[model samples]
Target: MSLALDLAPSASVEVRNVDLAYTRKARGTAPLSRFAVQADGAALASVPDEMEVRSSHLVRFSPTGKPATLQTYSVETLRKVEISTSGDTFIGSTDDDLYVFKDNKKSRFLSDRRANYTDIALSESGSRFGTVFCDMLAAHHTVALGDQTGRTLWTKDLPFAASAVAVSRDGSVIAVGGEDGDLWLLDNARNTVLKHRQEAAMEAVAVAGTNRVVFASGGGAGVINAEGQLLWFTEIVGETVALGTDSVARTVAVLARTDTNAGRLILLSGENGLPVWEIDYEDSRPTGLSVSANGEFVGVSLRDGTVCVYKLFYGDRLAAADGEAVLAEARAARSGDGSLLQAVALLQARLGSVPSDFRACDLLKETLTDAKEQALALSANAEEIGDFLSA
Candidate 1:
């Protein structure tokens, strides 16, 4: 069988001659004869999933916007819950078998009757994987894959059936959105729920950068900080079906589904949850929409098998530069350099006296602690500043 996908205006991705028998071919052997991909009429590499090609062949675009390797898995069909990145791949068969693919080699992660994996997600660095599975009573269990051994390093019990799982780019937290309309945050080290919110019928959830998580809920949408404080919310005419954030632009993108229109995409000012732009798709339904952390690219896939990739241009150099300056200042302050202490002090003072119109205001507390630690160390009064930060 073959499938051709129009991914962009002038570009297309195709896979062809995929085998129907799901068998594990020998490593370093002939690449699966059943699969192939072509981009813009140029032949792209294709690697079919083990034997029967029961799994979907993922054509992941790297962080740099270039097409990377193709990932395939062993299962009954594309429905076998698999996700991959440039570096790693996770696959779960319908029969509750779990497997991991790395460096073109495949191995079983779990092979027990209790190993029913429901959802799998990879961190941005592709260094870790998170999976949600079910026990005898259909309860949910989550497992975290260690980068070095491909083994389950952390596991925890969940309260509800998990629909989606995501790991932060920095691997500090794992967020789970479940069927019970609740979102749970798990600290990766202890595998414990750090926060939970049960108010919204959440369809999707994602962690943006290091500080916040955004979710698409039935009421509209929500943004919550690391402390689980509801940072912002926006009213919507439809159910928010998808949510994504771009760290570069400090913005969130939401896709809503309504009774009348197929769907619409809304861009919100991340700092305050204000709607900035909206685009509606009157005819086609979006199968998936992904946004880069930097907000540089937004990729939307339609049910008709077409994907649209949009590059957002801030187009405002002054404001864009100003945001970048603040981020740089924060980084410098944390580096224990006296030169940045004055700049940090200026930013903190600006935060104290100014109204809360900017995201910088919320960032001031961290800036003060980071800057003071650096300055006090040089003054011989450095007691680690833990009390100050905690207070």
Candidate 2:
């Protein structure tokens, strides 16, 4: 079967055999789908508690859709999780420990105080990660940064209990938001660079690029620069559920409830915090929100465990048309001429528009090697012809 999607004005692309499914009540917090698109244009999603027993699973799908399991990791009490831009590295926190999964190995790090982690964020490169920890007994909170091996680099104490934490794309800066309506910007050395006060309690925080950080508090959201100056602020109806930002795209995605208690996802410009687009859903509340690094897609995960991905267009007609044409050629050539180059290109293009499609990439790599060998043989024949002519 084929599906034609109108992603932007005057542009439509046909996707083949694409299907999506969701597992209900996957976890308390919404899951994150790393890059929205893998290197080969496949989409990847991380759903927590997919198999029960506090286990989380990584799933891969395509624009011409088929969903498949990529990997599964089990923990004692999974709390917060973040996936790297490449979708290969995973950082998560449990009730008392932090975990990092990379290269098919799992590493666990213990906290100094055995606190419950409330939120976690990772840099785009996945080399650094940060977490917000709450000390229930001490009635204090802490923000800690760690490397890929799960070693804590630095930890900063917060005056109020922190509700969310985020790190910049390059891991050079960190943003922490507290339940007491305070936002703090810190450097990599864990020193407070700037702080701002809001009107309501902070629910989420996300860092975009190097100079901007966005946070949601109660029913309101605001953007601030690294200098602590408020860039803009906007208020929405009902409670704010989640916030996400694409540092490369400089766009922010906010999830909130309506007056009637319906869920709505709003896309805003990170530069000035202006609304770009908004979508409403009648069934479930959004538990998580994410935007692709290129601002090409936004993903929303609902309370019922449904993860929906939408394509965003910034007016590249040539790229869109080329992607569509290559996808069509790849689909047709799948059982015909076997053009590995076209397939590889199609996969790469598809990833820019969708989430993960690792299976397609894996399958096409073998064909790519064969194609390379055939080209080498043809080059050898050409060289022989040249030598014969010379003789």
All candidates: TM-score: 0.60, 0.68
- lDDT per residue (tens digit) for residues 220-265 in model 2: 6777766777767766666777777775435667888774537887
> How displaced is residue 315 in candidate 1, in Å?
4.5
**In model 1, which range of ten residues has the least summed lDDT?**
32-41
Where does candidate 2 have its weakest 10-residue lDDT segment? 1-10
The top-ranked prediction according to TM-score is 2
Clashes of each: 11, 11
Per-residue lDDT tens digits for candidate 1, residues 1-391, read 0111111112121111111111111221211100011111111122344445444454543323445446554444333332332334444335465566666566666543466666655565556667677775675455545552467776777767777676676566777887777687777675555575756556777776446777766567777766666766777767665566654226677777765438777776666565545667777665455565555555554444444555554532124355557656766655655455665665665444322214554466666666587677766654446556778
In model 2, where do residues sit more than 4 Å from their true spots?
1-30, 33-42, 48-55, 259-261, 315-391
Output candidate 1 Cα RMSD: 20.7
Q: Using lDDT as the measure, which candidate wins? A: 2
